[model samples]
Target: MIRHTVGRLVSTVVIALTLALFALPMLWLAAAPFDASPAITASLPQFTLDNFAAILDNPYALGSIRNSLIQGGGAAVLVVVLAALAAYALSRVRVPGRDLLLYLLLLLSSVVTGTAAMVPIFELATRLNLIDTHLGVILVVSGGLLPAAIFILKDFMDETPTSYEESARVFGASPLQILRDIVIPLVRPGLATIAVWALASVWGGFLFQFILLRDPDKAPGSVILYTLYTEGGSPKLDLISTFSLLYSLPVVLMYLFVSQRYGFRFHGGIKR
Candidate 1:
C-alpha cells in the first residue's frame, strides 16, 4: 500500500512538472503583452495596451500580418489543390512503383529541407528571375510541402468509397464533375487538415522568406519578428511578446474554427 501510494505521488509530481514546463511559456505569452515591464518570467499583466500601441506604430509590424496572409494563404491553396489532385490520382490509379515513388519523394523532401538546399534553391530562383518575388517564395514553399501533403491526403482519398464515383458516373458525370461534386465534399476534413497544416508551415517559415525576399517591406510576419531585437541581439520582449500574440492568434483561431466545424476524427471510410 505504501509503495503504490508513493508511486502515485511520484507520477503526479512528474506530470505536474511536465505540465508546468509547457504551461509557463504559454502563461508568459498570454500575460506579458499587457505587462508594462514585460520580462521572461510570468507575472500579472498591468492591463496596458501600450505594448500593442508601440507595435502598431511600427510600419512593418501590422503590415507583416498582411504579407503573411498573402504568402501563407497562397502557398496553402496551391498545396491543397495540387495535393488533392495528386493524392486522388495516386489513390485511384495503379501505377507501377507508385508507392515507392511517393515514398521516395517524401524521403527526398524530408532529407533535403529548405535550409540544406537553400543555396541551390536561391541559384535556381535567381536564374528563373523569381528573386525578391512573393510568387517565387510561394512556389518554393509549395514544392517543399507537396510530397507530405499528398501522402497525408492519399490515405483520406483511398478510404473514400468508389461507390459515389460510380453513382456519379451512372448519372453521366465526368471525372472532373465527380471529383468536384462528390469526392471533394467527402474528403473535406482531410482538405481542412492540409490547409491548416500548410498555412501554419508557411506562416511560421522565416528562413525561406528571408532568403528569398530582399525588401523588408515584402517580408512576412515571421521575418518581421526577427527584426525585434536589440543591437546586442537580445529580444525586445515588450514589442515581440505583443507581436507574437498577434502573429499566433490567426492560426489558433483558424485551428479552433476548423476543429469545431470538421472535427479531425477519421470515420475510417465513407459509408454509402
Candidate 2:
C-alpha cells in the first residue's frame, strides 16, 4: 500500500507539472494584450480592451481568421473521412506488404517535422496548378496528418473484438452498412480526436501557407501573423499580440469545448 501510494503521488505531481507547463504560455499570451500601463509594461498587469479592439479592427487579421476556419474545418473533415476508411481497412484487411506498410507508416508518422517534404510538395502543387489554392493547402496538410490519424484510428479499431464484425456479418450486413452503422459509432470518439488534432494542425500551420500562397486572402492566421513579424510597425506590439491572441482564441475554445464533451470518449475502448 505504501509503495502504491508513493507511485501515485509521483504520477500526480508529474501530471500537474506537465499541464502547468503547457498552460503557462497560453496564459501569458492571454494576459499580454490586457496589460496597458507603461510601468506594467516593464512588468505589471493593467487591463484594457484596446489590444483586442485593434486586432479585430484590422482587416488583414479578420480575413485571416475567416480563412483559417474555412480551410482548416473543411480539410479536417475530408481527412477524417478518408482516414476512417483507410484505418478501417488497416484494421480489417491483411495485404502482402501489410506489416511493412504499417511499419513505414509508424516511422513516417514519427518524423513530426515537415521541413524536408516542402520542396517536393511545392513542386507537385505548382505542377498541378494548385499553388495559392485552398484545396492545395488542404491536400498537403491532410497528407501530413494521415499517418498520425491512421495510427490513432487503427489502434481504436484494433481494440474492437472480432466478434462484433462476425456478428454483423452473420446478420447479413454489407461491409459498407457495417462500417456506417456499427464500426463508425463504436469508434466515433477516436475519430473526433483525430479531427480535432487535424483541424488544429492546419489552422496553426505556417510553413505550407507561407510557401504555397502568395495572396494574403489565401493565407491562414499563422501566415498572417508572419506578416505582422515582417510589418514591424503596422499595428503596434499590443495590437499584434492581441490579434494573435484573438486568432488563437477560437482554436483554444474549440479544444476546450470538445475536450470537455469527449475527453473520456476519446479514451474509451483503448488500453492504457
Highest TM-score model number: 1
- Winner by lDDT: 1
Q: Which stretches of candidate 2 lie over 4 Å from their true place?
A: 1-24, 37-42, 109-113, 230-236, 264-272
Give model 2's clash tally.
Answer: 0
At residue 190, candidate 1 shows an lDDT of 92
Model 2's alpha-carbon lDDT is 0.80
Query: Any residue pairs clashing in model 2, and if so which?
Result: none
Could you tell me the lDDT of residue 200 within candidate 1?
98
Q: Which ten residues in a row have the lowest lDDT in candidate 2?
A: 36-45
Q: What lDDT does the true structure give each of the candidates?
A: 0.92, 0.80
Q: Which digits, one per residue and each the tens of the lDDT, describe model 1 over residues 184-214?
A: 8989999999999999999999888999999
Model 2 TM-score relative to the real fold: 0.83
